[model samples]
Target: MIITLTLNPSVDISTTIDHLVPEQKLRCAAARYDPGGGGINVSRAIHRLGGKSRAVFPVGGATGSLLEQLVAEQQIDFQTVPMAGWTRQSFVVTETSTRQQFRFGLPGPAWSMDERELFLNTVLTFPKPIDYVVISGSFPPGLPADYCAVIARIVRQRGARLILDTSGEPLRMAVQEGAFLLKPNLGELASLVGVDKLELDEVEEAARSVIQRGWCEVVVLSLGPAGALLVAKTGHADQRIERFRVPAPTVKKQSTVGAGDSMVGGMIYALSQGKSYEEMLRFGVACGTAATMNPGTELFHKDDVERLLNWINQSGKKVFLPVADGIN
Candidate 1:
């Protein structure tokens, strides 16, 4: 089973206003509420693509209760660890005239040391044999800097592959622990490799460095509209490392929210299906680009992903070795 962890979940409130004039008592359309968090959204997208994943996160207070209700409405299976603080909410306001979107996020409640232990224990004690464990989103306050590393060890002990999608120090620490794969954008990748920034020509070399160091088995570099680059060591000892670039499909733009998480979800779903790495990356780019065609935090539609995947395959994208038809 695929399991996702969102350390800090949220109740996302999005609305649109005709205009924004300073302190003018601006009015907005009726607010729309959706569950918001990296891994949570990944689970949501996976479900959208006809897959099942259990979402595990900490919840507290009335807002937490509402968050659970919202997720339940989406029919995603979940387990919540009790917490001492209320779950936070985020605001997304769009200016209809200019199509400008503004997002405001609130810090989550700090967890005490004891509370943090319980949280980790909850994940460690997951009953089933987890095939994939996805840990994404920001580290909640009061959590240790190496929290992802701790989680990496737990999942490793269970013999489950880990998919890490996080940023900053936690990401750097987690990479050292190693994982099945990582999806880091340009900026996050630069930081992990100790660079101020990376030029276009430096991406492949930088990504190759990460894999060469054995930090992770797979590194998927997300290049936004340009596409993604996949670099990895060969499974056979004598075989060489390989790289593939899946170009992004051009589409009308909307809100970019949830696109990255959707991309991660798509790749994970493809992996679960025993598809090739090229297929996984192709489907991932398809999902991400599709997500950008819609407004708000809404993810991609399955139909859109299917069409884009067809386009990618038709455009002669690079291929990777296929997985066994029956690996179960």
Candidate 2:
């Protein structure tokens, strides 16, 4: 079984407006709400692709109930850890004319130490023989920065492969404990290595550096529109840094939100099915492109993902790679 943990889940409200006028009343052309947070998005994507996974998150207040209903509608298995405060909510405003989006996010509610303990205990009790565990998204207020690292350690100890996607200090700490995979965009990768930013030439070097430090066995650096780079662990003579560039497909612009999560979902789905790393990367790129073809925070549909996958297979480009120096 696959288990995904979202420490801070949210209710995503996306609205489309015709135009924006300073401090003036505006009418919305469309509005939609969805249960969100990185893990929830991953679970939804997996379900759409006909895979099974469970989503575990903390919930509270009216918003939490609404989120539960949304998940139930999708028929995805979910386990909610009750909290004393309301779950966070994010608002996405899109302009129809300009196709521009502005998002307002709220800091999630605080979690007491007891609540944190409960979360940890629940995770430890997950049925044994778990195949993979994904720890993604931000930490709620009052939750320690080491929260993700602790979860990753437990997951690893239980014999399940771990995939961690996050940013900043939590991500740094989690990587130190070592995970099976880490997916960070180019910018996030730069931050992880204490660099201000990285040019295209510097990406592979940075990715290889992370792997050498024992942070993860595989590091996938996502370069939006330019595709992604897969850095393999050192020492294996056959190991080499592979690069894939999925040219952004032409699409009516909407919102870029959730594209990264969709990519993670696609990659995990392929991995769970025992696909090769190259195939998984292609599927991930396809899923991300599909998500961008849609509006707002909505994820890619099964049919769209399939279409993109077919296109990717037909392209048949040899993803480039960088030469590896023995360092394992």
Candidate 3:
């Protein structure tokens, strides 16, 4: 079984306006609401791709109730931990004229120590043995940075792979303790290696450095439109690493919201299906590219993913990058 944890989930509301002038009364269209948060979006995307994952998150107040209703409406299996504070809401407004999107986010209500313990216990103590524990999104205010590291330790004890997709200090802490896989963008990957920024040619070395240090077994560096770079070990005791780069298939762009989560969701689904690392990257890029063809947080359709995957597989020869020497 696959389980996802979202520490700071939100109700994502998206709408459009004709224009944005000098802050005059801008009448917006009817709003569209979806369960917003890294793990929630990943679970929704997995469901859309004909896969299943149990989503675990906390809830509070009326907004939290609404979020539960939304998740239920999507037919996702979920378990919620109760909290005293209200959940946060995020807004995405698009200017119809220029097609520019503006996203406004709120820092979620601070979580108390007791509340944090309850939430963590709920996640780790699920009745079924979890095959993959995906802890995505950001930590709520007041949670310690070491929280992710603690989870990593416990997950290791249970012998389940943890696919961590997050950023900043919490992400760094998790890396120190190690995870099965990490999907960080170029910027986040640079931060992991203590760099301000990285050049395109420098991506492979930076990713390899993380693996060499025993932080993560696999690193999938997301490159936005250019596609993704994957680095992983061929065996446990082996110093050698395998690398692959899959280019994104061109598509008519609409909205970029949820594309990263869609990529993670697709990759996790592919992994659960016993696909090769190369096939996982290909299918994942297909899902992410397909997500760009929709507005708001609608994610991608299975048909679009299939068509794009076929196009990607037909060009598989270009996907494999030449193997490089082991960590020295």
Candidate 4:
């Protein structure tokens, strides 16, 4: 079974407006709400792809109450720990004229050490033997930077694969702790290696560096519209690393929200289905690209993923999976 952990969950609300003039009261269309958080979104995506994953997160306040209702509406299985602070809320306003979107996110309420312990115990005692443990999203205030790292260790002890899709110090710490897989954007990858910037051509080397250091066994460097680069640690330690780049299929664009999470969800679903790493990236990129065709935080549809994946497979480039010759 696949399990997802979302520490800082939220209720994402979005609406579109015609025009804005100096803070005037702007009339907008009806709003839409969805369960918002990295892991929650991933679970939702997984469900849409005809897969199953249990979403684990904290709950507090009336917002948390509503979040539960939304998750149930999506028919996702979930478990929650009581939190002291209210859950956060995110607002997105789209400018119909320019097609610009402004997202306002509130920092979630802080949690106490006892609360953290309870959540950790909950994970350690998951109902089933976990096949894959996905830890995504940000750590709420007061949670230690090593939050994901702790879960990484636990997942490893259980001999389950851990896929981390997060950023900043928490991501770095989890990498240090060693995860089975990672899905980091270009910017997040640069930060993991202590670089201020990276050229498109340098993405492969940077990703391999992470694998060689034992931080992760595989790295899926998401390049947004350019698609993703998959780096796997295979064969002898002295051999060159295996890598593949899948370009995203072109499509009508709507909102960019939830694309990355959708990709991670897709990849996870593919992995569970025993697909190759190359095909994993292809299907993942398809889901992410499909998500861009919808407004607000809506994820991709299975039909869209299938159509895009077919195009990507037919037009795949002659990219070789080179074995890693170690980090140096």
List pairs with backbone clashes in candidate 1. Answer: none
Q: Estimate every model's Cα lDDT from 0 to 1.
A: 0.88, 0.84, 0.90, 0.89
Better of 1 and 2 by lDDT: 1
Error of 2 at 159 (Å): 1.1
What's model 3's overall lDDT? 0.90
For model 3, give the 10-residue run with minimal summed lDDT.
319-328
**TM-scores of all candidate predictions against the true structure:** 0.95, 0.94, 0.97, 0.95
Q: Rank the candidates by TM-score, best first.
A: 3, 4, 1, 2
Q: Across residues 174-210, which tens digit of lDDT does each residue of candidate 4 receive?
A: 8888888999988999999889989988888888888
What residue pairs clash in candidate 4, if any at all? 239-324, 239-325, 240-323, 240-324, 240-325, 241-322, 241-323, 241-324
- Tens-place lDDT per residue, model 3, 1-328, is 8888899999999999989788598899999999989999999989998899999999999999999999999999999999999999999998989999888999888988899889778756876677898989988898899898888887877888999999999999988888999999988999999999999999999999999899998999999999999998867465678889998998888899899999999999999999988888898999999998988877889999999999998888776564756766
| Global lDDT of model 2 | 0.84
Candidate 3 has a TM-score of 0.97
lDDT of 1 by residue, 184-291 (tens): 999999998999999989997888788777788888999999988888765765546777888898888888888999999999999999997878898899999999
Error of 1 at 63 (Å): 0.8
Off by over 4 Å in 1: 317-328
lDDT of 3 at 124: 63
Which is the leading candidate under lDDT?
3
